[model samples]
Structure formats: C-alpha cells, structure tokens
Target: SSLGHHDIIEYLLNHDADPTITSIKNLTPYDLAKDKETRNVFRRYMAEHMDKWNWSNAHVPIEKSESTSSASKKNGSSISGKSLDSSSSLIGLPAEMRTRIERERRARAAEVRLNAMQNRGTPKPLTLPSIGNVICNVCEKSLVGLVPFEICELKFCSTVCVKNYRDREST
Candidate 1:
C-alpha cells in the first residue's frame, strides 16, 4: 500500500487497529512509515487509544540505521536512537553471526564491483545478421543493431510500441 489514506487509518485505529502488526518485511507500522508526517499521524492516533495496544507484544529489535526519523525519536519512546555504525556491541556478538553478516556484505560489495568493472569494459557493437531480414513487430520497420522488444521471436521497433502492444493485449 502507498500509505496515503489518512482518514481510513484514523477510523481503523478507532475501531481497534493493531499498530504492532508485523509487515512481510518484519517491519512494524512505526518502521514502515517513510517520513515524520505519517509517524506523527500514527503516534497521535495511538496516543488517543493507548489502551488497545498490548504493550508486552514482542517486536523484533531493528538495527538503529534502519530506524525512521520520527519513530526513532519523540513520543517519549524511540525504537532505535543511535546509528548502527556507532554500535560497538557488535564486537561482543557471537563470532559466527558477525562473520556471516560481514561476509555477505563483502560478497555483495564484491559482486557490485565486478559488475561495475564489466560495464566499464567496451560494449560490443550490435551487428545485423547476414541471413535474414529483422523487422519490428510493432512498426514493421527494419531492425538494426537493437530492437526495442523481443517477445517470442518477434521484435518491436521501440519501447513505446512494445508497451502499446502489451496494453492492446490486456485491454
């Protein structure tokens, strides 16, 4: 959801909405909200009906760097106040856990660097095959080095034409 419906959220809270519900990403309503505006709105509604919440509900403690601005401060309670970079307690964490996370991060960085290096290499020039005539499925134009689309052995002249063809099929 885009999180745009303020009135509906207010009504839902009034009728007993659970702010602690964990999303697919394991984020609470307080975590998923992108900005201070939505956080404040949720906080205000929650304050108005604090009795409905089960304060004892266990929520996964998110890392401080992942905390949103408003939810990480104000309202007398902050989920995560400090940046994860400043968290020295990671040194005390079990070696396997720290090593695993560090390894994964390093691997991802290595992959990204590899991809960057590959992209930096010269791009091979697209060549027209000598065998057959390649024609655009949408505009029926002759295809050169690149065709906009390649559906099922079919080619399109441009991105616009490919989208138009898809829309035509859907409608």
Candidate 2:
C-alpha cells in the first residue's frame, strides 16, 4: 500500500521497517517524493521517526537546542508587548544633534588639513634687532630655520622661544 500519511510512515520506520524495501516498480517512498512539498512532508516524517527512536534510547537526555531562545532574543518581545532589550541598547539621537556633530567633525578635519599645509616645509628664521641672528628664548642660542616660534607681536626663531613666551604670558 502507498504511504498516504506522515504518522503511518513514521510509525513504520520507528518499528524498523526496511528503508531499502522497494515497491514492485522498484521505487522506495523516498524516491516517490517528486516535488518540494511532498519531499518536505516526507522529511518531517523521517525527523519524527528519528526523534522517537532517539527517545527510546537510554543514554541521551535530549536537551532542547538554544536556537529557539536565540531567535526569540533577536526578534524581541515586542509582539508580546513586553520589554526586549533596553531602549539604551538602541542608537539614540535627535536629527539636529547628529547633524551638528557631523558638521563639527568636518570643520575640525578641514582646520587640521589647513594647518598641515601652512606648516609644510622648513620655516623661515625670525630676525630681531637685539640679535642679528635669530635667537632661541630658552637656550639663548642662534636659532636656525629648522625651528619656528611666534610670540605676542613678535616672531621667534625656535620652539623653545614660543613655549617660554607662552609660559610667561600665562603667569
């Protein structure tokens, strides 16, 4: 007789019905699943039989897999009108604040690029009346073009001068 239902197929398989048992036409039940739906139904029946056979075994406890829990965690409990993850888990922002932050970041980047361009190459040494040679404020030595410094209303010849001048100004 042709297997018409999943329960019968599962029951027969569980009782050790030979999977190799072929019909007179030389086809097994697995071979008769010619379409996707029929194949899926047959697959489910096979799974049920496996489950029953596993249950009959003495050793295995058969713990449920965490796949269901993980799925529920991702989907959240919104469907059940309960809290899922906290609202703090989501990205929080008003449109204006987001736009302003982006704008400020762009402005800072542009300023950095401008400063880099201005600072490129060797800096020119500053000349002064007291020292015909450009002088360093900290060491009081002749400053070279290698280091540049700016003070209030005066340009200095070395980084030492710039730092010392600023330190003096702060006090």
Candidate 3:
C-alpha cells in the first residue's frame, strides 16, 4: 500500500515488509502499481526473489549453469587466438555493439582515404596567375607586378608571401 513512492516501497520490501498486507483501499503494494515502469520493477524484484517468497517455478541464477561454463570455455579458447591485452578495452561491451563501433571506425577510415585519394595529384591554386614576368624574390614565381621593398628591393607574389618572408627573416 503506497501513494506511488516507489523508493519507499522498495525499502519496505528490502526490510521484510509483508507483500500480502493491504491498505485501506483493499490493495496490496503489488496491486497498487500505477504505471508500467513500477509494474516492471515489481515483477523483476519478485522474479529475482521468488524462492525467498516460497513461490513455485523459481529462476536459478544464470551464472551457475552448465551452458555458461561451456560457453566460457569456448570464449576462452577463442580469446587465446587473439591478442588478450588488446581485447581488454572492449571486454564490457556486447559483441554486436563492438562490431557496430568497428564498422563505423572502418567507414570513417575509408571516407578519409577516399578524400585523400581524390585530392592527390590535384594542383592547389596557391595564388592568382601573374600577367607579366615580374618574378617574386621569395618563391621565384612570376608576380602580377613586383611588390618591392625599398630596404633590399625584394619582390613577392602576394602580400601573404611577403609577410611570411618578413616574419621568417625577423625570427
């Protein structure tokens, strides 16, 4: 019997509260479950402790089964074939989840490879083409017009190239 305080209901159950005890509404705590989540919680708790409640068809813990032992033996043999140290990182995740993650990783790697291959051997437009043969001093490439510095009469293709050359010389 509760006013929907699920935590209090759980605490009462943990402390040996009688499940059959009814409230003024003539409803036991299990009967008073107002929502699906609460009902599911109650069902799972009852399933886990069915033996303690003297219930018929009690579920045995899965870890104590013979199938688990055989499955573990198979897993151990399979694990031995791989690098044990590398497998430790993903030990907690399920096989399907890990496979999905690996697939995504491979997809990203392939995308990057494709982008690199597409860009390979393609000439990048670093600067606009020059109209005359006035060459830049820094890159030795023809500039639209010589950008002359009075100090050394140095010419550059662009302002960006001239600034980079000046920065390097200053350092």
Best by lDDT: 1
Clashes of 2: 0
TM-score of each: 0.31, 0.23, 0.29
What clash pairs does model 1 have? none
Per residue, candidate 1 scores C-alpha lDDT tens digits across 1-171 of 137566666677677778678754344665566555655567665555546674223121223222344543544343354334423424465887566546645554654564464357432222235656665544445675773566765567788867866886676
Q: State model 3's lDDT.
A: 0.51
Q: What are the runs in model 2 whose C-alpha is more than 4 Å off? A: 1-3, 33-38, 45-171
Ranking of all candidate structures by their TM-score, best first: 1, 3, 2
Assess the local accuracy of residue 92 in candidate 3 as a C-alpha lDDT between 0 and 100.
68
Tens digits of per-residue lDDT for model 3 on 41-153? 55556766664562211111111134544555666743533323434434566997566545644554654564464357432323323444544544445554455442355
Q: Where is model 3 poorest over a 10-residue stretch in terms of lDDT?
A: 55-64
Please give the lDDT score at residue 98 for candidate 3. 60
> Which model is ahead, 1 or 2, in terms of lDDT?
1
Identify the leading candidate in terms of TM-score.
1
Selected candidate, larger lDDT, 1 vs 3: 1
Model 2: lowest-lDDT 10 consecutive positions = 55-64
**Model 2, range 1-171, lDDT digits (tens) per residue?**
144555665566667765555554344565554454444444554445554433212111222235644555677743442235423222265766455545644554654563464357333333445547664543334555545465543556556567765786577
Q: Kindly give the number of clashing pairs for every candidate.
A: 0, 0, 0
Whichever of 1 and 3 has more TM-score, that candidate is 1
